[model samples]
Target: MNHTRDKESILQLYNKVLPKLAERIYQNLTEVTPLFDDFRLEKIVDTWTKDRNASTDKEISIENGNVQQLGLKLSLIGFQAAGAQTFDLSKDLLFSLDYSYYEVGPDKNSRWMEKPYFEEWTSKELDDIAVKWSEEVIDEITQKLQGL
Candidate 1:
């Protein structure tokens, strides 16, 4: 088994695999994400309104009965090294996420970059986990989507 060959295969898997993953994760989240119902929505509005710490007031938007401006962004990066003559090739993957949460601060309003999810994972470990999660979720959602 050539390790260099394996690295290429895995990289190809992600390159080829991720478009499907993104589509699935997005569609699944959209379908599963629920708007706060009139009852639950009050809780959400209360949560936002309780946010009195405002150096700057910001207008909020609602969409499909849910907060439209709920914020977060995610990214994944990958790298690989061909194995030495004596070793199998290796790969390193990073799963990076950026997002802010609604939290009150000194002035009662603040949102900041929460720690990236992959802090628990090193660069190599993160890629591996991200790929695995993507693959598993994709398969699971595909079946679920088919039913829907």
Candidate 2:
């Protein structure tokens, strides 16, 4: 439990899966509203902080057990408009993701877009970000639990 996972590997995982995640959510939101989902690598960014802990369970004595916890916050930079909002007529159409994470006692969050207006993003966008973080990032962490 003493090796660190390279940041490059983590970034690769994020890039490969983020857009796919977006597409999955987008397809599900094909109804009513003309709004649709499209994956944007340009304005999208994901940041992850790794906290590694090494300890054994007190309840059940284990020789040596270690756990690595990862906190990922995904953000989106886009544009959107409110009021009689027409995507076609909107003057501004940019917004970011609402990402909040907490581990033990520490809490980290993504930047909130509170300018011209918060982008009224489709549920798919939010859902996709969450899924990618949990799937691509969390899964790998669980597989290799070691201190970084």
Candidate 3:
């Protein structure tokens, strides 16, 4: 019922739990980075303070990277081979000869790729970590409040 106590409890939750949750999420995201050829995505993933109900707010943020673009392309139509082309040449005549040639197209092996690391990891995994950390913080606070 005390406003000051309520504020302190919220601060304790933010200060003790959010950082650990963010760190765990960041680590899980980084683990999936090796699946990508470009490592920049791993480097750009970070946790920062945001202005949410005061300066005590914290959040995990990822900067846009080329990996996202590549993932989209792969997801839509698979990987296209660079510099691939198909050619054909033919002639028709009495007692004549004909020839034809074509280059193989790009590999359509989309299976080699996966959904964007950020998307897959953040969908439910991050939330689960946050919930676990939150429960830990709440239990700790309750114990202290009850002098257990």
TM-score for each prediction? 0.22, 0.27, 0.23
Model 3 C-alpha lDDT versus the unseen true structure? 0.27
Candidate 2 lDDT trough over 10 residues, lowest sum: 60-69
On the 0 to 100 scale, the lDDT of residue 34 in model 3 is 36
Q: Which tens-of-lDDT digit does each residue in 1-148 have in candidate 2?
A: 2222333322332344334544543343233123312222221322222222324333211111111222223222221323322222111111221122212111233332221112233555456444443343333333333321
Better of 2 and 3 by TM-score: 2
Candidate structures ordered by TM-score, highest first = 2, 3, 1
Spell out the clash pairs found in candidate 2.
78-94, 78-95, 79-93, 79-94, 80-93, 80-94
What lDDT does the true structure give each of the candidates?
0.28, 0.29, 0.27
Model 2 lDDT on a 0 to 1 scale:
0.29
Per-residue alpha-carbon lDDT of candidate 1 for residues 6-74, written as tens digits (9 for 90 to 100): 223323323443333344444433432232111111011211431233344444323111121222122
Q: Residue 136 of model 3: what lDDT?
A: 42
Per lDDT, what order, best first?
2, 1, 3
Clashing pairs in 1: 53-107, 53-108, 53-109, 93-127
Tens-place lDDT digits, model 3, residues 1-148: 2122122333332344334444653454443333333322111111342323343322322221111111000111121223432221111101000011111111222121222211223435446643443344334334533552
